[model samples]
Target: IQQKEHPKFKRKGDDLFVEHTLSITEALCGFQFILTHLDNRQLLVKSQPGEVVKPDSFKAINDEGMPMYQRPIMRGKLYIHFTVDFPDSLSLDQSKALEAVLPPKMTAQISEMELD
Candidate 1:
């Protein structure tokens, strides 16, 4: 896991800005598996961290038939899982535009396990 600190700003008074520092942490989880054949005892092995997000989290269903509550996880971030993976060569402007459409913290935390 890696943590980075960034300065945050808020408007105060007529033309003043207040600043504070915030931290962000990133972690990588890995998994490995092996398949073995009984006849020759041959083994096939694979290892991966998997994709950042799962697809089903973005699926939409009729509210009438769906359960009263639903939870989803995306990009290792809970509740804020609605994201589209563009090609590796996407431009910086394109990426920023997509990020602008993300849900706010409260909506994103709708499925969070932590109380606070």
Candidate 2:
């Protein structure tokens, strides 16, 4: 039987793939959102407290995909592909604040030129 195309999900061998976009703040901080399944069920999706989701990262949900063929009770995996959106520019104060909270910047060393 041919499966109908879902607006937010792509099916591949019973597995479901969905792309989710997040802001820079949400990528660094934690985030929570609801996802609607094929059966019109709402799923609460969230990141761990210390979990930092990078760009193009994937999160898999067990048994949340399309039902297995023949075995109606069993299901595949639901994968969420995440993409982070960054701001166009940051002010000097914002940069300094981020620098203070984030890791220290690496300094490049310059060697003195020898006299010709």
Choose the strongest candidate by TM-score: 2
* True lDDT of residue 114, candidate 1: 72
Candidate 1 lDDT over residue span 1-116, tens digit each: 24233242222211212221111111112222232321234333322344233422322212211112233221111111123333556589976865686454354435455755
Worst 10 residues of 1 by lDDT: 19-28
Candidate 2 Cα deviation (angstroms), residue 82: 0.2
Clash pairs of candidate 2? none
Local error of candidate 1 at 37, Å? 1.8
- Per-residue CA lDDT of model 2 for 1-116, tens digit only, reads 76688788999998999999999999999999999888889999999998999999999999998889899899999999999999999999999999999989899766676432
Candidate 1 lDDT (Cα, whole model)?
0.29
Q: What is the lDDT of every predicted structure here? A: 0.29, 0.93
- lDDT for residue 38 in candidate 2, whole number 0-100: 80
lDDT of 1 at 7: 41
